[model samples]
Target: MALPSAPPRRRLRVAVVGAGVNGIAAAKAFRGAGHQVVCYEARAQLGGVWAPASHYPGLRLQAPRELYVFPDTGPLPPPEYDEEYPTAAKVYAYLKSYADKYGVTPCIQYNTRLVRAEPLYDRSDGGAATAASTAAAPGVAATVTVSALPTHAADGGKGLDGAAKGTAAAPAAGAAPAADAGVAAAVSSTGPAAAPVGWRLTLRTVPPELQQAEAGQCGGGGGGGGGGAAAAPAGPTLDKGGEGQDAGPREWAEEVDVLIIASGSFDDPKPPAYKGVQDFLAAGGEVLHTAHLRTALRRALAAAQTQKGQQQPRAGASGGAGDNGPCAIAAGASAPGPAVVTARFPAEPERGTEEGTEGGMEAGTDAGTEGGMEGAERDACRRFAQLLAGGRRVVVVGNGKSGDDVAAMLAASGAAASVTHLCRRNKWAVPRAFAGLVSLKWTLGTRAGVSLMRPLHPRPWPLGPLWEAARWPLLRLMEAGMRLQQGLAAAGAVPPHPLDVGLDASLHVEPPGYFAAVHGGRLQRRLGAVGALEAGAVVLGDGSRLEADLLILATGFRRSMPFLPPDLYGKIVRPDGTLDMYHAIYPHEIGGRSLFVLGWNPGLYGCLIADIAARWVLEMAEGRIRVSREQMRAYNERLYAWADAHFSPVAAADIRSGITVAYTWAHVDDMLHDMGASFARLTPWERLRLYCAPVAADLYTKVKATIPSERP
Candidate 1:
């Protein structure tokens, strides 16, 4: 079962965008294959979505610890992380350790972004090469634009982009000199005469002061101050500069022989547009996507501190009797009314007394604030917690895993007066530990579990008909079991679709205490789209209104490749917003072998899938796995057709989603077969184990070990 040896290839100057799971894998793979590699990460740190800036308060891994590991890196250290599902911080640390172990950490250039990547070509033949010219002669085949991000840690620590505390920031390595800050091109060592076939990349350098200000505005919850009243901006708002800002970002350029995009799909946050959102913000109500939970929490604390500082009388406020105050509502509450305000603030004491004063000092004195900033911050945190558990009315949008986790977290913590969950429909959710005994990794994550489901194409002979006949009953039985286990029927949250249909659409793991919260009435579930927002209430699609102080949108992210040229982007992405990639890797229209995309496909285990994709890219680069344009087109057509038939309409509508969820093993097997790995040709015993054994990352160790190393 040995694979045919690939012909030795020339060393390539490879540039990888992103330093996340996929990016690290790509860098390690390319470097191992004797290619020059440098990875660009826009954030000050790696870990991708697990980075500190992206963590929500109660975030934990969706997959079990064993299934989330990188095969080459082995399992997460058990002694350090005892939880079956590790917290976000633990996962981030594990990723960092993995990157360091593989030598990928030092190769990463933090705080550097890939702005644009355009194909380059030679026009010496009196014919210019347009993006449409697939077979154009290659001589300097592409041009990429990159920018140096600000020198600031997103989580409010010391800047990791090469700046010391209270000191001026230094320019990133390879940045242009101060005088030539504007678009300077550094030709390859081969010179203009040679013009080797590669990408010419432009780099932008942001000045330290402007970068600091931008970081202050958008990062670390705006230093936990008055600016926290609003949700954190999705990204750095440097483009929309204020008075006294720098003229613009400085620019430079370089060249590379290859470009790999591993930015992944979670980059763009998709907060839906609601009517009167402006009014909501103006009224001091916060609207945040789940990605900005840290920011939202900080803002809540800051607003609470401000209100405590003011110590205004409740009677002067706009709302009716039992109202804490306008400022209290702004902090996180609605007035007592028929709108179902279930919590209230503790009664305030007379203002002049020390007991009523903040920090136990007399009312008019500055002595209460004398304990310094740290002490004040602690007070704010305590007050914010009280407000969260005792007074706030929160409305959560979407019912995906994130939505469920958030609602459950708030309810379990008693963080809201009324926790209302809004969604179009309920999704089927299974518990992490099936039947309260077997971990899902051993059930749904195993090949045996996948075998129970119908395949993308019809199987041969009697087995096909038998499977088809049994599938419906099996789905119904599974649905009934899950319904009883989750108490979905009792909570009136049972999904309308069967188990198979539900999996095809989206499968969620029930968050801890979610069903309990629902039954106990701490969390209320409402099925409808939000129609509008007015003052302190949310209007539902049926014209019913619910009092709300905070809104959290777990609506997920939008897939985009803004860094690619428009023509190339259009070719790779369909008009309907679905990706048009071949096996979710190569673009059909692109003729050259210089570009590759990783981490686009969603599956059961991200780290394992991404590592395999990286190895597949390495194989293609080394000429070990080759596909003709016709072959790719044919395969993609079949793939899309299968998706249309097997997936739910909602899931099939966007192929970039978790389309391979339950069938991830089949997808992995296909890729391994393409790579001609010996593991793909398993013995009878190994094959049996493959189907019956619990799935783990270590299963692919042999495949990884067999990949071609650097040629002498």
Candidate 2:
């Protein structure tokens, strides 16, 4: 590999992937660091997740625009919050504006998606050592050794010394076993022990030849200044499913100075990681993979590949862990910010009074059906002044963070929102109902009891099903949770600030996948009340049954950060085939620089972590901090160790069977530690991974020698 131009003696070349919010925000930081940064995105649009026309109907911003807006931007003025929440268009507009302000638009290549992101390590600096957690960091010649956990009991919750229900006990050995442990332990001891282990992630991998997302239309590899072959043509998108889709082979570009992965949890396509990913990993890629990976991801890619059909692809949104947070932990209530009012018309005090259905539900009553449409009975006009002077549930129906807050408040206040209760958890809305319980993610999964819903089926699946999308994100959250615990266990360091949290789910939608019209992957299925009903807690397509006071759909959006797949570090994929990316950033094994997620500052409030994320990326790009391999690992270990000390209490609880659960508080809790000890702190999480990588080189051999197999 020759110099793309002799690596300009005093300059560093950074390959900024994606121009979405996360990617763009990162670009700002990179620019600040004074690096020659070139950003690429697949779509012709600059806003990764903010592309408007592609957003679904009635879509509103997940978090308060104020909290969610990029770092240096201001949300809509006061009057904006007085009425309704910001819609996807509103947010997207804001995103575009943000780009304009930060000078991000110019540096971004709209149609160029980062088909691949890699770290172009300076070759002169010796290549990575095989399986060595102890190797000296890149650029730095000194060897740094990270010791095991300290003896201090790490846990920041109600001191374990008190023995209260919310206390953080020592890390228990009963944590999850390897991913291939055969059957998954019940979601909790209570979830249907007999409920087939974890759901199989059966990806109906549409054979390669016909995939979307892969169509290189964005002028990909047009040439150096142009984009060489990266953008040859476009492909079929999921907007046209199961058809003549022509996508590219899983693309690769692992060797780069900086890598950014922009695909989010449920949307963008992820053709199975073939040779490229494996080779990159084998050679040490600084990839940062996310749990948002979902079936639609592939579908989106497939959609992109549907070139013969010449169909367009999806924008950024997906379906999973929206505003309500993934599990009970994230669902716990935070202080109420301005409640974005949806319907603003006055409640007509009648059962059915048709208001305005022009563009959106007029702020008025729509003939009260059950319980006077919850909040519509009170204060609809004051919420959003821009809306009409009436009230409607539609404003609150779609799961906006504001709506969830309002609904949760109503539920906690001992009132009914007219939503059906998930029979097993004995809670309303499957997402947030049982949040208060320590680990009762869902009562069924926590208690050793049988579930009302029977098994969907069972089989060997490398990837979980797309139907179980809500629960998939938890898999990675759990893995990170486990490694945090394990790292602390070995370090023996006492956890300093443990968090006690709860989660809730308000994301409700009809299932039994079928669509009346499919243009751009938007399934006009008989959704909402008309399409389906929960047969036994699980939402099913019935069309005739619509029983509930409210329905809040928590639709997650698309995302992609830096260095995914091959260009990755940490224990993202343990030998057990489990993910261990601690804090959603660095890997548990090798602590390389990383980019985690960001959204509403609700569950976790550490602007510092966000700041740090922005800062770290910038520092790495500008050479302010040359992250050596060991330094990277050590940093990860230190953070995980601290994360365990601070947030284990919330995750330790058990979740329910067949229900998606997440420790929102715990996830955010890590943010707290990150806020304080970011970058500068050489905590255990970082040290261990950095040193462990080398010392444990041939890590498997070391383990095998210590514990010989009986078969031998």
Candidate 3:
């Protein structure tokens, strides 16, 4: 595939506020367009969520491996992975390789954090500048504040030696590094004065003690890097000298022409704020998000080893080197893998035991009527098993891919005495391969399959007429096939909403052996919200309670750019809290001139989607794509209306943050059209294969080659 040639325009100083998949894509795109790019990553590594610190046991790609690769990079080698979905470690390695292959690694500033971004609108007319101001004078348009977090051993900060390779070293304490020399020289040579519409960014260096302390709360130890540090409070601190003393991390500032927020949606975990949470913590119960499971489990195992030493004072009592003890290693010595277990489906429930009208719980009294002594003994045994990594009662909240994976991991671990999964809604679980025969990538993942569903926008030509006639029948057929493959009815996991409606919300792949765990009674699947937390128990919305030694909330994340000023932030987020961006990349109000947001949209094939979005950003920056603010707003309004109408009410509330499932193909198609590139440009045979064969990242390389190399 031919790369887009450098445009015949003055170079841009592009600042990307992340080093994740989307961030790498943005940097590669801008740099390829002959722009100077710098990507800032909070962690020492560049994989974002796939970073070692963010991974938990049993973490694997929910999508097929082919669908997860960057468009420009192609697929993971089959001989290397030999799996439909690769594990987190494998993905991280792939990302690092991709970065190196594309020269994006050197452009990344490791251990740098975005604090705040204040727009510096051109006010040459002497008028006060505000976020709403639309002055187009070029140069510096915004001031972004970023903190350089101190690196620690636990943070894997040595991945790139604490800075971009071949870049200048960090400046002395309290000193601001000069602007990129290459960029400064280019600016001076191009014109009499630099453009006045660029951004001025402020930088700070965090105190090591304060940064390490924050890292500890967020699973700061080895392999469990500071994934939760973004949630930690950020600001200047007061000195011991006096109340007026301003003492904090070292601060400085810089400027840039374009600011792309590739920070992603999963920065902040959104655990439920149930009543009595503090009491539960005080009572010695552990509450963790799926992101921190590895750290929590390691702590439990270490504590168990300590207890064993105290109880049995003899050598090798804890476990002989070769002994397969209670904490015996599973698939890998470093991380737990899925355990194979026999499945025994429960007999049909009595007539009255079906899903209840209230909370989807079985219609019966709470299961707390067991003899008091027996219940107490059972609780004590479970608690002891928790320490030994054997018999803890685990409660996992949420039904997304993370929740399913975690629940399955615990159930199959042969560790938890019982695994209870609590969710507010049951979702259609799509299998990677339907009936162990047809890969979803060849069907629903292709453009032809997307044409079978209702579209947010009008389909073009032949597809529109075909869809109008066969949409319902095709969708129904696909749903039936999914139902049969998933064995939803047999597993007692039929979702309330139909598959079409569910697609608009979220699509979670059924984890291996997940349904078997449910059928065998090892995992209890219930539908209800967590009403509150009590001493060693979780109270359900139906007033029922379950004893739990560990609570894992896979309840998802809250997406926000807290660094943006309130007025600017409000322009991007809607009144009801959904994002209001045009094409989920350009802020509608700003029209994609000085700012772009990537990876904010919830969708499938994220790597491919982000790459397309990045290319689109490049097109906009080079003046190949243009739209007025009114046009952008109209487009966004239509998108919002489509979502409200098609998405499930519950899903609609947080529509922009969850995966859009099957519509992802449609989303990509829309962007392709906007960029004047399409599958229509392919040869007849290639186009046929594109619609019928399993699509991979490399398939789009040809399509992207048709994108004009320079603005006309």
- Residue-level lDDT of model 3, residues 1-712, one tens digit each, is 1112333466666778777778888989898877877776665556666655443333456556666777766534533345655555567677778877778887776545555455544332332223321222233233322222111111211112233111234423642212222222222222212112345444333333344432323322111111322222221211223222124343334445578888766555556567876666566565665434433433343444456555422111133243322222222122111100000111111110100011110011111111111343233223323443355678989887667766765665556778899988778766667877877776666667666766767768897887788878877777888777767787667777766665643465666677777877878988889888888899998999988866877766555665665556676887667666767787655332567788676565667787898998888766566454456567666765776787676655545533345366667877777778857677887777777655566768889988765433
- Alpha-carbon runs more than 4 Å astray in model 3: 1-8, 74-82, 125-196, 205-210, 219-249, 297-389, 460-469, 654-662, 678-680, 709-712
In angstroms, the error of model 2 at 108 is: 2.0
Quote model 3's TM-score. 0.73
Candidate 2 lDDT for residue 33: 53
Best by lDDT: 3
Candidate 1 overall Cα lDDT vs. reference? 0.54
- Residues 47-128 of candidate 1 have per-residue lDDT tens digits of 6655544333334565566666677764343333456666555666777777777778877654445554655433333322
Give the TM-scores of the predictions, in the order they appear. 0.73, 0.38, 0.73
Q: Can you write out model 2's per-residue Cα lDDT over 116-144, one digit (the tens) per residue?
A: 22221111122221111122234222222
Q: Each prediction's Cα lDDT score?
A: 0.54, 0.27, 0.54
Model 2 ranges off by over 4 Å? 1-9, 74-84, 117-255, 268-499, 503-570, 573-583, 587-612, 623-712
- lDDT, ranked from best to worst: 3, 1, 2
